[model samples]
Target: MYFSIEPKTSKEDLFNFDEPYAALKKCIGLNEERLVVVFGLRRTGKTSLMKVVYNELDMPKIYIDAREIFPLTPLSTNQYLVSIFIEFARKYDIIKAILEHVSAVEFVLRAEGKEREAILSSILKNINAEMQKRKTHLVIFIDEAQLLKPTGADRLLAYIYDNLKHIQIVVAGSEIGILEEFAGQNKNASLFGRAKKQITLNRLRPEQSFLFLKKGFAQAKKQISEKELMAAITEIDGIVGWLSMYGWHYLKIGSKKALETIVKDGSKIIADELEAFLSYRGEARRRYLIMLRTLSIREMRWNELKRTLELEEKKKINDSHISNYIEALVNYGFIEKEGINYKLADPLLKRGLDFVKI
Candidate 1:
């Protein structure tokens, strides 16, 4: 089970995060209705932690991986909500007719904003009432919640939080793209001023990282020395997902190049996701790539990044431009700032960024 690399759902699959597991239980138990935001960098187990909470709680739940969702297009925010709900209903086997008129509500009707929210609100109320009749609470868990387009999502979710007594939505997302800002922390964003519970996952400690690999190999009935496990911890720097990838290939192909294979394979995965974020940036792609490539090897100061960009562009770049670019990357969880230095947040992504060749 530990050898499995997909977003884990069962308790038996995840390795660590005792603190976060407890925190999640308390949040759902204490708050009758509240927004709980769980976030971390890519490959850091935010999704797995969400699954642990989803499975632990005694409730009716719906889990959506927002990464599988694309951004909004040719629709109002309410339409986005309707579309996502439609997807949810289809995936979870929620009786379509129990949704009442949801199937009948056409896309044309959703564009009329007020009526659409009313429709959605009514469906949620019905679902909540059913949940109460069954003596179970409703938890709507959206993992990779950052990938959701902000537009009308917060306002609609805010409505559900306020109007439904038996239903609550808990969202988990990576820092990869706009997740931090979309989370209603912005005064202008919907769900603003409402109290929120946030739990951020950090990388595994050195000892825990070694144990994770040790236990994973043991589960596979493979023999790997403690020294080899420690060497891996040092090489990969304690990211659980990346470590799992290395362990997966190492088990399949017992050679030194398995390490190189992880890097090559990881870059393709991280780069594909990164490129999706980059696509929405328009003409600013060059500048962002420059910054990411530079930070791959060294931490940088704000001004230093600006000067480098200006020299490369052969044109004057303003403070706001540089700041905005970095802010976007930070929001998505691709880059992080500590003190005055800025650097890529994921070690595997840093290795992958080298191949990005900005």
Candidate 2:
């Protein structure tokens, strides 16, 4: 049977680009420079971007996805560092063996009151020791990397980046705001003033979405009307995951009415997410989410949003407060703005707002 959701092939998965190779080339060009901050709203293809660019670099590379190793939410920065390094040691044999050897030194150093620093300090020493013995360069990538607790990660990254000549380190995450929050401008901090390059991964434009849809339908041996295809794109606002879901939904429905149902059903998924946002505690956050939802459905002027807020009987929110709410939302990565206009940065959120009652 043909599949609608098979892992998009490396070539076909280039979702939004007529020339993904060119995009990959731009990313590869960054390798000659210092750290590149690869970030985007969740599922805007940040990880895919990393994979494509990293593939071009011919080096001994390691990709560590932090999502796989759950972040310790309650831990302090120092404690988090210990946990992260322990996890790192347990997984990579070369790093593990090197650390184990350093633990011997650590045990001795503990008696001299240097045990705390010994683990991290000696790990670096061991990396150099290994490099001399093995004669190779190391490129390490940490994914979902925004989750790394700021305090400890700052110190660790700074030390590694400052000292390690042979190891090229790259950190990427789905949430750009989270990373910016982590890398605050404290000179003593790990990544302070250290991001040599920053890259933003956004959704495929409308034209790119059309191309991907056509390519995907051909692969699945299905044909879609231009109206149906454009409807899906408008509904999902050009997010790849939602586009793929539309393709999957289109394949299962045989009738035109069934197609309408798929769109309606998808809208409900959007609505549920919107309800969750509005109901979430923090009045400013709720208002911001609601405002973004409204913007997604139809553009509203500043005073118009105030008027709309006043009309809501259940939501006793203030018109003047909307600006502050929008600022907070933008800071926290929930929404984005261009001049006076603003909208939900994530398309799924847009669908959820569409599901919300007028």
Candidate 3:
């Protein structure tokens, strides 16, 4: 079960993070006032934690992955809202009436601008009224919520948090910087100054990773040597996703082939993600790549990295420019700072870098 590479919905399949699991469960069960935000590196089990808590709690709730309904236009944005509204109605056992009203209004394909806003607001108000009548609460769990930024759905979340007394919102995202921005960690945003509870998932330690792999393999009814386990731990570090992948693959092939497959497959996935990240960062993409490539070789202090960047570019890049680049990388969870040095947050990103073209 541990080696099953899916977002775990059962606590038994989860490994460690007992404190986070307990805290999150209590927060939702008690209907905490503050919004709950779960943050972590991409494969550090944020989804698993969120889903596990959602499944354990007995409440009126709906979990939506914003990535699936990412909107491309105003019409699509309204459609997304209607989708959420319909899901909420279904969860509350009001879908029959809600669909009747939705069809009568023809809001799906026609609603736009203020009309869409009004319809969404009305839907939430109605849902809140139903919850009040039933003397219950509704929790909206959104995964990868940063994807909703451009759709202006954060403002909708802000409205729900402020007006609906019986509704609680929980969101999880791997992109820490963007997720914070979406949640109005910035000064000028809808959710600005709003109270929030945050839970961050970090990579496992060496011992934890070893035990995780050992236990996972045992559950699979296979045996692995300590030396082989140590090698996998050393290479994959502490990312649970990679550890699970290794364990799952080792059952079919041997250790060497599994590691190689991880590097090959994982790098491709990370490469596609890095490419997407860079697509939004105009002209400065090359500079970011140079910095990442330099750090990929080894960790470096500020001055050392700056000198390397300047040398590679054959031009004197300003201190502020270097600082911004490094800050962006750190914020995006691509790199981490220790003492006075910076390095890739995941070792696999180095192999990913090989696939990235300049």
**Number of the predicted model whose lDDT against the real structure is largest:** 3
lDDT of 3 by residue, 1-358 (tens): 8886677888998999798898788788354555899988889999999888888778788888877774455567668767777777986687765555576347546766887787777777878778778888788899998878888888888998888977889999988888898888988778988998888898999999999999998898898899999998888799999888888888878888998888789888888888988988888999999999999889999999899989988999999998988888877788888898899988889999998887
Ranked by TM-score, top first = 3, 1, 2
- TM accuracy, model 3: 0.94
RMSD of each: 3.4, 5.4, 1.9
> Against the hidden reference, what TM-scores do the models get?
0.86, 0.72, 0.94
Q: List residue ranges in candidate 3 displaced over 4 A.
A: 29-31, 95-101
Candidate 2 vs candidate 3: which has greater lDDT? Answer: 3
Tens-digit lDDT string for candidate 2 (307-339): 666565355556557666655566555577656
Task: Report lDDT per candidate.
Answer: 0.74, 0.59, 0.84
**How close to the true structure is residue 131 of candidate 3, measured as C-alpha lDDT?**
79
Kindly provide the TM-score of model 1 when superposed on the true structure, using C-alpha atoms. 0.86
Error of 1 at 172 (Å): 1.0
